[model samples]
Target chain A: MRLLSQARVAGSVLLLLLFSAFTLPLRASASGQVTPQTVAETTQCGHVSLQAMIDEAEAGDTLVVPAGTWQAPIRIDKPLTLEGQAWPVIRGDGSGNVVAITAPNVTLRGFVVAGSGKSLDREDSGIRVSAPNAVIENNRIEDALFGIYLERAADSVVRGNTILGMALPISRRGDGLKIFYSPNTLVEGNVMRDTRDAILWYSPYSVVRHNDFADGRYGLHLMQSDHHLIEENVFRNNSVGVYVMYGTSFELRRNLIAANRGPSGYGVGLKEASDVLMEGNRIVGNRAGVYSDSSPLRPNTTVTYRNNLFAYNEIGLEMLPNTQNNRFQENILLDNGEQVNVYGGGDLTRNEWAFDGRGNYWSDYAGFDANGDAIGDLPYISKSLFDSLIGVQPELRLFQLSPASDALDLAAKAFPLFAPQPRMSDPAPLTQPPALPPTPGLESPPTATNIVVAVAMVGVALTILAAGLRRSKRQRRAISAQPA
Target chain B: MNGKIIWTLAQKELRDALHNRWFLLYTIAFIGLSLALSYMSLAGAGIAGFAGFGRTAASLINLVLLIIPLMALTVGAQSLAHEQEQGTLAYLLAQPVTRVEVFIGKYLGLALSLLASLGLGFGIAGVVLALANGAGSPMAYISLVGQTFLLSLTMLSVGFLVSALTKRAGVAIGIGLFLWLTFVFLGDLGLMGTAITMRLPVEQLLWLSLLNPLQVFKMAAILDINATLDLLGPAGIYAMQEYGAQLRGVFLMLTALWILAPALAAYMRFRLRGDF
Candidate 1:
C-alpha cells in the first residue's frame, strides 16, 4: 500500500511538469499583452524614442511601437519581435532603408514602412533584410526604392505584404520585392504595382505564388535562377510579363500574363533557359506570346509549352528557327496575327507541334471531320506565301489576304518551284476550342461582322440563282417560239 | 489568216455588241460595284479616306471573281449561239471569211469588248484607290486587274467551247452558266471535300489547282500578297522556293493555255462539223 501511493505521487508530478511546459508561454504572453512587457523591461509610456527602447531592452525582448510615425531608419540588430498595436508608421528620412533587419530570427509585422532614398546604387528599401530566418509579414510598404530587399537572407518568409513603389520611371525605381542570393524563400500573397520588377536574382528554389504584379517594367524578372515555382500569379500591363533569362528547371503554372505592351513586348521570354515547363498559362495580348532564343549553354534542350492559351498576340511563338526539340502540345492558338513567326532563316521542322496523339486547337482551322471523330481528318498546316514574303518584306503585310496574294498562292500551286514549306503543322488537330477559364471582363467573342458578311453573301447567291433561273426559263420559252 | 477579213468581221461584231447594249450594261455594273466596294473599304474600321485604298483592293477581289466570270460566259455564249440560231453564221461562212477566220474574229471582238468593260470598271477604282492610299502598291492593284482580265478571257473561251458544242441558244446559255458556277464555286469545294474525305497529299492538291482556271486566278492573286501564302500552308512555301521566278510566269502561261486550248477546240469543232 505504501509503494502504490509513492507511484501515484510520481505520476502526478510528471503530469504537473508537462502542463507547466505547455501553459507557461501562453500565460506569459497573456500577461505580456496586458502590460506590454513581461520578458524584458521596456519604455513605460510617455514620449520616449523607439531607439532608446531598443537600446534599453534585452536581445530577446518584445517592443510594441505606439500608434505614431517613427522617424528615420530604425536598425534592428537583435533577435526581437517588433509588433505594432495599430499599424505604426515607420517613415524614413529618404536616405537609406527605413527598417533594416541585420540580426537573425527577427519578426517585423503589422507596420507601415515608407520613404527610402532614390539612389539605385545604394539599394535603398522600405524593409531590407540581410539576416537569415527573418519573417516580414502583413506590412504595408510604399514610396520605397525597393519594397523588400533580401540580401543573403536565406529561408526567409515574406507573405501578405503590400508593396507599392513611387511614380518614377521603371529604370529609376527599384523592384517591388528584390531577392539576391536568397534561396528557399516563400514570397506569397504580395500585391505589388508600379515597380521596376519583382526580381529573383540568383535566388534558387524560391516559391513565388498568388502575387499580383502589375504596371511594372517586368512583372517577374528571373536572372540565373534555377528550380523556381511561379504559380497562380497575375502579371498584367507590364512591359515584359515574365523575363526568364538563364533560368533553368522553372515550373510556370496557371499564371495569367497579359496586355504587356512595350518595345520588346513579350508575354514570356525564355532566353537561354532550359527545362522550363510552362503549362495552363494564358499568355494573351502581347507582341509575342513566347519569345524563345536558343539555349546556347545547353544545346538540344527541350522547352515545352503545354495546355497554354495564346491569344490576340502580334506574333505567337516567335522562336529562333533552329530551336530544336521545343514541343508545343494542346495549346489554343487563337486569333494571333502570325501564329508562328521564325526570327531567322532556318528550318523549323525540328520543333514538334504535337505530342502523343493531340495537337493544338487553331482558331482559324477550316477542316471538317466526318465519322464523328473530334480530330481533324487532315493535318492542320499553317503556312502562307504571303506570310513568307512578309517575313522578308514587312510592308507587304498591308496587302495581307489581298486577291493578289491569293493569285500568287495559285501561281505557287501551278508551278511547283514557288511553293514554300509549311510554317508548322498539327497532326491531330482539335475540332473545338478547349474550355479555358473565362478571363474576367475580357470575354470577346468572334466578330459579328464576319458572320453577317457570310450570311449576306449566301443571300446574294440565292437571289442571283433565282433571277438566273427565271431569265433562263424565259429564254427557253423565247427559243421554243422561234424557228429551230 | 487574212488580216483585212478578220478586221472587218471583228468591227462588225463590235458594232453588234454596241447595238445590243451589252457593253454599256457590263460597264455600268463594273463601275458601280467597284466604286461602292471601294467606298465601303475606305469607310470601314473608322479609317476614312486615303488609308482605306490599300484595303479596298482586298475587298473588291471577291466581287471581281463573282461578276466577271458570269458576265464573260453569258455574253460570249449568247453572242455566238444567237448568231448560229439566226443562221447568220451560215451567211458569214458563205462570205470570203473561212470558219477559222470567223472564230478568231469573233473571239478577238469579244476580247476587245471585255477589255473595254474591265478597263472602264477597274480603271476608275484604281485611280481613286491610288489617290486614297496615297499611291499604294499600284503594281499590286494592276496585277489584280490583270488577273481579272485573264480570268475573264479564260471563262469566255470556256463559253465559246460550250456554244460550239451545242446548237440552241438557250442550251448554250444554260451550259455557260453551269460552267461558271462549277468553275467559280463548286470546283474548289469539290477538291477540298475530296481532300478531306480521301486525305489527299497536299502536293496533289497543289497540282490539282492547275486544272481550274478560276482557281489559277484565285491562287495567283492570293500568292501576290505575302501573308496569304501562309494560308496556303507549307506546300505553298515549298512551291515558292522550287519555282522562284518561274512561278508567276507558269501561272500566266497556264491561264493563257486555258484561253487558247478551249478556243482552239471550239474552232476545230466548228470547222469539222460544217453545220453552220
Candidate 2:
C-alpha cells in the first residue's frame, strides 16, 4: 500500500504532491510506483460498457466518469476511485441509490447524484458508503434517505458539495449527511438545504468546517461522539442550530448562526454533553440563544463558552437547574429581552462588558460617556437592576418597555447598572482596528489570545505529565514496602 | 459437655475450610472477575448501565446468576457427602457431639467465612472504582456496599440449606445452582419468551412476568428504593411502574426462602439420620 500510494502521489499535481511530500515517507518514490498504481489502473464507468469498466478495475483502480448523463447506480465492490469529469450526472431510474460504494478508498466527485426515495424499507438516496475512506466531494445530491450516508463507515471525507435533502422525514428519519462509528472525517465547504441535520457525528474525531446549512430541523448535531472539531459553519433558518446530547467532545469555533427557532430545542443546546470548548461564534435572532439548561444527564456535562457574540436572541443565555461545573468568559451580550436568564443553577465567571459605560454598551444603559470615549463611567449589573425594578414590581415591565419613558428616566440617571460578577476587560481596547488579511472565508484569524490558550494547554499537559511521573514513583515505593 | 463438643466441631470445620485448595482457587477467580468488571466500568463501556451496576437494595438481581451457586456449591454440596465418603462423620459421631451441634458448627463456619470473603471482595471493587472514577457521590458508594453484603448473606443461607439435604455433594451443588441459575437468567428469559411466543394479552403477560425472580431483581436494580411502580399492562409507562413493585416483592420472598428452606432441610435431615 505504501509503494502504491507513493506512486500515485508522484503522478498527482504539484499542490497535491506538496501536501503529501512533507508527511509521506520517501520509501515509495514516484519513479517506481506512481504511474502504475494510480494512472494506469483507473476504472472508467459508463452504461454502454459496464462489464468492460468492471474488468478494467483492479483492487485499487481509479474509476473515472466523463461529463455525460448516466442512468444507473455506479456500484463499486472493490477498492477503486470513482472520479467524475466536470460534474457528470448520475440519474437513477426512480429506484434505489444513485451510487453505492462498498469497499474502501472509493472517491466520488463532481456529479449530480440524484433520485432516491423509492421503498420504505429500501431508501432511495444519492450515495451510500458502507466502508471507510470513501471521499464524496464536489457533488450535487438530492431527494434521499441521506445526501451522503456513511452508515458505519470510518475516516471518510465529504467536502465541497451542494446537497439538498428530501423534504420531511419518513417517521422522522432523514439526514443530509450522517456518519456512524466513524472517526477523523472531514466535512467542509458544503452547501446543505432542507435537511434534518446538515452534519451528524456518531463516534467522533470528525471535522466540520465552512459549510452553509439552512432550513433544517437541526443544522449540526453530535450524539455519543467525542473529540470532534466543528469550525466556521454558518447555520441559518434552522429549527435548532446545534443540538448536542449524550457524550460529546466538540471544539466549536467561529460559526455564524442566525434566525433559528424551535418550540422546545435551542439555538445551541447542550444536554448530557461533556468536555466542550465553544469559542468565537456569532449567535443571534433565535427563540432562545445558548440554552445550557438541565437535562437528566446534565450532571456529567461541562462546557466552556468564551469570546463569542450573543445578541438579538429572545433569551440571551439560560442556565438550567441541573447543570454544573460550566464556566463562561469574555463574551458580549447585547440587545436581548433578558440578558442573563439563569434557571436557578450553574456557575458563571470572567466575562467582559462589550462596552462598559466605563466602556460597555447595553443599548438600554442610562449612563453617559462624559469623556466622549465611547464608554460610560459606571458599570452594568444587569441582574440586580432587572431584579430591583421588574422583579419587585411586575407592572413596571410594561411601563419600562418604552425606549423613552417617564418615572424610569429618573431611575436611570440616579443609579449605575451593577453587573453581578466583576468584568475582565481588555486594558487596551482598539482605538483603530488593526489591519488584517482580506481573506474570504468563515475561518477566524489565529489571534494572540487563541495562541496563548493553545500554549497554556500544552503547559498544563506538561505539568500533568510531571505529576504523573512523581505519582508513579510513589506507587512503586508503596508497592515495594519502602518509604519514598 | 454438648456445648464443648460443638465448639470443638466448629473448630474442626474451620480448619477443613482453610485446607480446601479448590475452594480457595475459585474464590480467587470470582474476585478476579468482579475486579475486571469494576475496571471496565471506570474506563467506560457502552453497556456500563448493566456492567457492574450495583445499587443500594437491588444488585441481588445478579445474585441468581453466579454468587448464589458459588456459595451453595463450595460448602452446601460437599459438607455432608464429603465427610461421609472420607469416613470422618463416623469418627466424629462416635464422640459426644450431638448431630445438632455438629450441623450448627459446620454451617456457621462455612457461612461466616464465605460471606466475609465475598464482602471483602465487594469492598475492594468499590474502593477501586471510587479511586479511578472522576465523580460519584459517597451515598452511591455506600449504597453499593450495603446491597452487596445483603446479597452475600442471602446466598450464604441458601448454600447451607443445600448442604443439609443430600449425601451426594454433587447433587447438592447442582440443586443449589439450579435455583440460582433459574432466577438469574432462565426465569426472566422464560417470561419474555412466553410473552413473545404466545399471542397472550399484554396485560395478562405483565401480571404473569411478576413471578420471574430475575425480573424482580432487575426492577430493584433499575429503580432504586425511594418509590415503587405499579403496572397495569404488558408494556408502556404504566406497566413499568407495576413491574417495579411486583419484582420487589418477588425478590424479598425469594431471599427469605434462601434462609428458611436450606436451614429447615439441614435440621430435618440431621434429626432423621441414625449414624450418630
Q: Name the best candidate (by DockQ).
A: 1
Per-prediction RMSD in angstroms? 18.2, 29.4
Task: Report the poorest 10 consecutive residues by lDDT, candidate 1 chain A.
Answer: A23-32
**Residue A245 miss distance in model 1 (angstroms):** 1.5
Task: Name the lDDT value of residue A208 in candidate 1.
Answer: 89
Residue-wise C-alpha lDDT for candidate 2, range A239-352, written one tens digit per residue: 788877776567888887766764443578887777788787767656557877443254455577665656555556765645556655455554545565554422333333
- Give per-model TM-scores: 0.55, 0.45
**How many Å off is the CA of A428 in candidate 1?**
1.7
lDDT of each: 0.72, 0.57
In the range A1-484, model 1's lDDT, one tens digit per residue, is 7556545654454354345422121111111222222222222332445665566555655555545666758888888777764677888878888988999888888889999998899999999999988899899999999999999999999999999998897789998889999999999988898989899998899998988889898899999999899998888888899989996788888888887766567899888888888888888767678888874337655788888888656677777775767888888886666788776544567777788877888766878788556778788887766567656544343333334456666777788787878877788888765555433223322223323333343354344333323334455688789986
| Candidate 2: regions farther than 4 A off | A1-52, A118-123, A167-173, A295-301, A343-379, A384-484, B1-276
Which ranges of candidate 1 are over 4 A from the true structure? A1-46, A295-301, A393-417, A437-484, B1-276
- State the displacement of the C-alpha of residue A14, model 2, in Å, after optimal TM-score superposition: 16
lDDT of 1: 0.72
